[model samples]
Target: MTNLSQNSDIADDEYLSAFYRCAYGHLATVVGTGHQPSRTVEIGSGRGLARLSGHSWWHSDVLPSEALTLRNSAERLPFHDQSLDALILKDTWHHIPDIEAFLDEAHRVLRVGGTIAVFDPYWGILARFVYRFLHQERWDTRTPQWSFPSTDPWDSNQALTYMMLRRDREDFHRRWGDRFVLTEYQRHIGPSFLLSGGVSRRTAVSGAWLKRLLSWEERRGPWFDHFRFFHVFGLVKQ
Candidate 1:
C-alpha cells in the first residue's frame, strides 16, 4: 500500500485521483442542491473543493498557506457582522478547541437565513472500530463533553461531531436555539470513505467501482443509517 500525504500532489496517482473525485462528487451535490450562497467561506479548507462546484468561496485555515485566502481560527472570524451568506466546514469542527465559540463566530458573520453546512465523520459501529484501530485519532464517545482539553488549534477528539449531533443532539438544539436552526441531518456514505483511503492512505477501490458504490449508496443509504460513517448537516442562522 502507498502512503499519500495531504501536502503532496494527488492528481498523478490513479487511486488517489479517483478517491478525491468520488469524495468531491458528494460535496458538489451538497453545494448544488442544499445551499448555494452567493458569498461563502470554507473554514479549514485544505485544497478546497468549492471551486470544483463553480462556487465563489474564500478559503481560510488556522495555518498560513499560499493556497488559502486567509489565515484565521474558526473561533474568531475576521469577517464583519452578517457579511457572509454561508459557512462550510468539512471535516473541520472536530478539530476546533471550542465549538461553541466557533458557532458564535459563524452566527455573527452569517446573515439571518444564512446556512452553515458541515460534512464530517459519523461515529457508527464500523466507523468507531476504524477510528479506534486503524486511524491515528481519538474516538472516545464517552468523553464527558464535546470540547477536548487542548489549547492547540489542531488538537482534536474525532468523536465530538458524532456526540453533539447524534448522542447529545437535544442538548445542541437547546443551547443554540436562539442563534441557529438545524435544517437537515442525515447519515451518508457508509463504506465508501474506507475504500477511498482518504488523503493519507492507498486507495482500495477503482474510480469506476467507487462511482458504482456511490450510486448504490444513494439508493439504500437510509436503510442502513445506523451503520453509515458520515453525517451531512445544514443549519440556518436565526
Candidate 2:
C-alpha cells in the first residue's frame, strides 16, 4: 500500500501533473455549464484545484493543512442554510461515515439550483483489481450498502461510490430525486494516472505524451464504459 503522505509529492510530479490537469480540466468544464454560484466550497481539498482556479469558494478538509482554508466534517458542513451556490466533493464521498447525513447537509447548505459535483474512483473490474492488490484503501466489492459501518470518518470503502451510483443507481434516484437533480454521470479512464504510478511509485509517463493520450481518450468517450476506472457525477439542488 502506498503512503498517503506521498500525495503532496505526487501532485507535483510532471507525469501526475498531466493527469491532474486533465482531471481538473474536465471537472471545470462540467461545473462551468452549471449555475455560476457566488459562493462554492470543495471538501477534501487535496491539491486545492478549485481554489487555484480563482473560484469564489473555500477549500476544506477534516485535518488542518497549509492547502486548506477550513477544517470540518462532511456530515456537518460549516455553512449557513441556502448560502452556497455549489459544493465539490472530489475523491471524498467514500471516506464519509454517513452518506445520508453528508447529502442532507449539502442539500441544506446549497441554495436553490445550486450544484454538487463529485469525482471519484469507480469500482469496475479493472478498478477492483487495481485497488484491491495495488492500493492501500479497502476495496470490498461484496459490501451490501453504501454507508460505512464504522464511526471513523477516515475509514473508507472505496467501492461505495460504484455501489451507490452504478450498482444501485435506481435506488439512489428513487430516494433523492425530489431534493436533487442528477445532471450528469460519466465513466472515464485515466491511463495517465495509472502510468504515473499514483502517489507512491516512480512515474512511467511524460507530461506531453500523457496529455496526448488524454486527448485521444476524450475523443473516444464511448469506450470509457469498457475501461472505466473513475467517474464524475453532477447534481443540482431542487
Candidate 3:
C-alpha cells in the first residue's frame, strides 16, 4: 500500500544499505576468496548503496557521461571475457527478462575464479501470503506483462512462475555445471511480518531513538527470524 517510488527518504537508503551489507557479507563468505575483491561490479546498481562505496571500487551505472565507466544491461554485460573478480545483483534477478541469458552473460564476463552473487526474493510461505493478500505484487506463478510505471498486478494469470526458494538450488548447480559452482543457497531474513504484513516504507519509523532501539532489539535475536523476507544464492565461475 505504501508507494515506495514516492517515499524517497534517507531511511529508505539506510534500509537498502543494511540489506546490501547483509548481501555482501554472505557473498564474501561464498566466494571464499579471503581477500576483498579488488575489482567488482554489480548489475542494477539503482541508487548505489549496493556499490559498497568506501569499502571497494565503486562505479556508477553506465551513462553517456565521461565520469561513468560501466554501462550495459544484465542480459548482455559489456565487459570483456573473464574480466571481473566479483559480480553482485541485489533485488534485480526477478526483473530480468531472461534468466538463462543473464546467467550466460555472467558466466562469460566472469573470470575463471570470479564469483556471482544474487540476493533475490525467496517467495516462501511468508512472502507468498503477504504478496497475495496485502500487497500488489504479482505472485511468483505469473509472467510479467506490464512493464514499469505500474504497480504489481497481483493478477491470477500466472503461467511460468519462478519460485526462487521453493525449488532446489541444485537445479541451478546442474544447469551451470562446472562452469559455475553454487556455493550457497541461504534463506537470510528468516521469517517475520515480511510475509504477513505488507513491507511498507513505514515499517521502520525514522528517528534517532527508534534506530537505537531497533539495533538493540536485533542483538536480542527474537524468535521471528524464521520468516525473514530475503533469500540469496552465491556462485563462483569456474
Ranking by TM-score: 2, 1, 3
Cα lDDT listed for each candidate? 0.73, 0.73, 0.54
* Candidate 2 structure quality by residue, lDDT tens digits, 114-199: 88888888766666788888887788778787777875556798888777777888999899989999877776755655665664
**How much lDDT does candidate 1 score?**
0.73
What lDDT is reached at residue 135 by model 3?
58
Per-residue error (Å), model 3, residue 177: 2.4
Q: What is the Cα-based lDDT of residue 135 in candidate 1?
A: 81
Residues 14-36 of candidate 1: C-alpha lDDT, one tens digit per residue: 54454445444555454445444
TM-score of each: 0.84, 0.85, 0.68
Q: Candidate 3, after superposition: displacement of residue 32 in Å?
A: 4.8
Against the true structure, what is every candidate's RMSD?
A: 4.3, 4.1, 6.6
Q: Cα deviation of 147 in candidate 3 (Å)?
A: 14
Better of 2 and 3 by TM-score: 2
Highest TM-score against the true fold, candidate:
2
